[model samples]
Target: MAELVFDYLIIGGGIAGTTAAETIRQKDQNGSVALICGEPHFLYSRVLLPEFIRKEIELDKVMLRTAGDYKKNGIDIFLNESVCDFNSQTMTLKTISGKEFRAKKILIASGGRPKLWNFETLLPGNIFRLQTLDDALKIKEFLSSRPSGTALVVGGGFMALEFIAILAKYGWKIKLLCAEKYFWPDFLDETGFGILKDLWQKNGIETIFGREIKNSAELDADFVGVGIGLDRNLDFLPHAAIKPPSGGLEVNEHLETGTPNVWAAGDVASYKDRFSGRRRSGGNWSGAFMQGRTAGLNMAGGKESFKNIPVYAISHLGVNISFVGDVGPFDEKFGVKTEEIRFDKEKKEHIKIFMKDNRVIGAVLMNGQRFLGKINQAIMNGWADSKITLD
Candidate 1:
């Protein structure tokens, strides 16, 4: 119904989008920037959703940016507005509400959403999906009614563990079903998983590994929490090619989408990485934040390339875990090899280094954080240059 023209436009209101908008304003103060957020929220930290659920932090702490921040920066924010289609030729993007946005340059940082069991069919009863602040609030509300209940969380990813921890905090019994034999099957080795399993048991978490949820009705539980994975929002833009494996918009080193005058950041971008030797998506918080800044710089007429060695770390059930570089299983086509640093019996820790054709590809650390700096160096530069002596 209304047409909004801006010097630059961004799709998404998460940390990445917010960071980009702020960076753009800092770089080019006079650029009329407009950001479209699908959610009503201005900007909130997705990383702290579990903390909010556990009541470890106040809701105010979870909110990263206020309306005043945007107002002060002169960033025009269109909340609760989702872009439906983007036209590269006309440099116009149409929203679901028929609002059109035409900009000189655009950045798609739409991020990701929780994957429902069935997209076409309606979500079954008592099934929980945690991806937004609203979702966490609903979960908190649900827990308030039932003082004691059984929560069956399905998945081994970050959110699955978060669900178990939160439910346990609320004095609710938990049943965990991981899709793989071990938590982080691709990333962790025997000793690494053993450490996590021990932590879960210590916290009274009953885990059932290798059980993918096929039916919700068959399971007996008060509620089911699904944390399988997140899905990219690319259905609207068919013009941009979706890269396989990562399922994100393919971007060059500078976060430039092959499409003209368009760029991407956050989880939506499958950017070519110098360290990882592949086009990797910004799956974690640090990746999203850095990519947004990099993308914003390039969009605002500054030249910058993203140099990153992927690192994902989490603390749940009183144990710290980290996955770095290409932690997942390598493709069958590549001549892959693995060299393990083995577990430290005294330290109760494990370290496994993945190599492909004699190059340091990935490393998984479980309580063995002393080598973190060296592992990072190895992944970025080379193993020999890392100055880490492995026995």
Candidate 2:
């Protein structure tokens, strides 16, 4: 066992941990900082993993920061260190490789591992879960061979949809099944989802929603990819602290967890949206980066607020989709001016916009052309509640 002390110890090398470290260095140049990441590669965007699989993006392009960048800032980086446990009383942590480190404050940005099926035996080699850069590279290799047969994708979300879109373009038989009736249910309403359904079906990808995967052993395919969501990697901490059992670490408006001197960020952390004040969980890259920066600033003895306007975006099947501010559920509560356009009703071209007062609170477009910059700006500038007169 080895012992060391630092001003801050960040557990997780993902975007959250990286941003936290950078933010800390930006604020306090004299304090010691250490970052522990399980993966050997530098910090990369987990959201772009699917796109990397489709060959639409190169590995180097999506990688934002490198380990060397952190080291230059005087922050110690530990790669390939898998944390096994943490003790708050001693302010120490033990890794699976039988190493120990002590610090003044710890930030758990370890993130989450993909949820895999609990099996009595090792599942077949064809099954895959895309949670890391290596996983995406492996899938890329698997697809390069152009293995004969269709892909059965399980789950419904931004990642699942992106996977289906990219894989379908590669000329592989694709069968997408989800347990929800609509795609991106959290962001898109029934009308918006209907538009996506039409586009997906038109592309020759069959989708079945609101259905559970009863058994995978009976099903056979050239390959299977599952995106059943993620669970917060909080087994090392007491369960009672984090409320809302569905999400990961729990925090107040300030992003502080139940444990003293322990803060959380990234997909592993859940907090209230600044606008709606409702508990929200976002596994997206933007959310993780922002949260990590806020946590780091706070940990470094700076007084900063974590409040922020909601932001989300994705590109699939030539459709660029983005959402900002309080959308969806807000449509019902707020009397927003709503407009919809369905081009070629039979062809499934539609776009819907929800404007509260005069600002854009939400929108959905599928197989249609509509620039999103204006809408996103309106939402962030607090113009969503203004009265508008369209030209």
Candidate 3:
């Protein structure tokens, strides 16, 4: 029944929310700012969690900020607190612990969570998902305590690849089981997938396709690593019908939520792309961090639009896999066309371009090339992809 008031409020404690808080302080120092964090710990790097789990980096390296830092900046951070109810009409948020936070403006940076199978009820300790720092710590601990054994990784994205790498290093038998036969068929072309598949085989990692894990025991894995997908954490959104086409909070170029005194950023924002005019959500850490800055600027009485070419890159299985822009579901309905090319024959480098109306919209590259900058610029301006040359 405690009531707190602030000039501005941020819901997530990830990079987005933390960056937004810092940006808000820079813009309006006197504005009372309150950040409600669902996690008990302060901000940390989600991108580094994989490296930490792999033991390539120390746990202390993952910590990005301390409570002292927030206090120094005059930001009130409520860790281990989450909103249970939201009243958009009054701009009021009720926490799970019955604390009320009233703010003149609010930001939604709640991000997303790993999608897990309900099998946790049957085998709790064996099922794992790597989405947070805690998840990485627990996974590392689990591996340290148990002997190397068969591991089943169910996913087709970056997280699944990370799990494979970590398990393989631990000298465990690893099998990648995903429902997609061509993994990222939307963005990655046949050659890109072929390259990855070949690399997987070279590393002695088995690949299983067109399958779903209904029974954990049936897979014969000592444990399961689930990275099937990321679900937007909209639990605080209530039953309100404000969801956008991307399944996150709908936002304009300025990151405004289209609701009075509200804005959204990071993984939880389904913002209209400044280039394509299509709505999409960005999952990469850099994208979230920049979006938070843009949202913070606008929320502090300045008008600014978020415009960044979405880029995601990861080194896995002895190759560099990079994706830019809105890859697949290019919506043939929108007259989208795709082309794949092997840019470097000797190095086995490949690129796939997805376009509509001859404008570059998205692309994927394996063993990526230097021309990535041109691709980004072309996608940003909706420029004709014809001028983008590998040479």
Best by TM-score: 3
RMSD of each: 2.2, 3.6, 1.5
Give each model's clash number. Answer: 0, 3, 0
Quantify all predictions' global Cα lDDT against the true fold: 0.82, 0.74, 0.85
Per-residue lDDT tens digits for candidate 1, residues 207-290, read 888766565464678878888888898778884378788788888888998888899999899876665476677678888889
Candidate 2: residue pairs that collide: 357-386, 358-386, 359-384
Question: Which regions of candidate 2 fall more than 4 Å away from where they truly are?
Answer: 118-122, 326-391
**Candidate 2 residues 175-278, lDDT tens each?**
88888876777556677786677677778888888887667564466777777777777666665655663357777666788788889888778787654445
Best by lDDT: 3
For 1-391, candidate 3 gives per-residue lDDT tens digits of: 6689999999999999999999999999899998999999999998899888888999789999998999999999999897888888999999888899899999989888876466767777688889887888899999989899999888888888989989988999998988887777677767777788888898999998877777656657887888878888888786463564578888888988768889998988888776666778997989999999998999999898887888899888678888888775656676778887446655768888878778888888888747688788878777776778776
TM of each candidate vs. truth? 0.94, 0.85, 0.96
Ranking by TM-score: 3, 1, 2
Task: Candidate 3: list runs displaced more than 4 Å.
Answer: 343-346
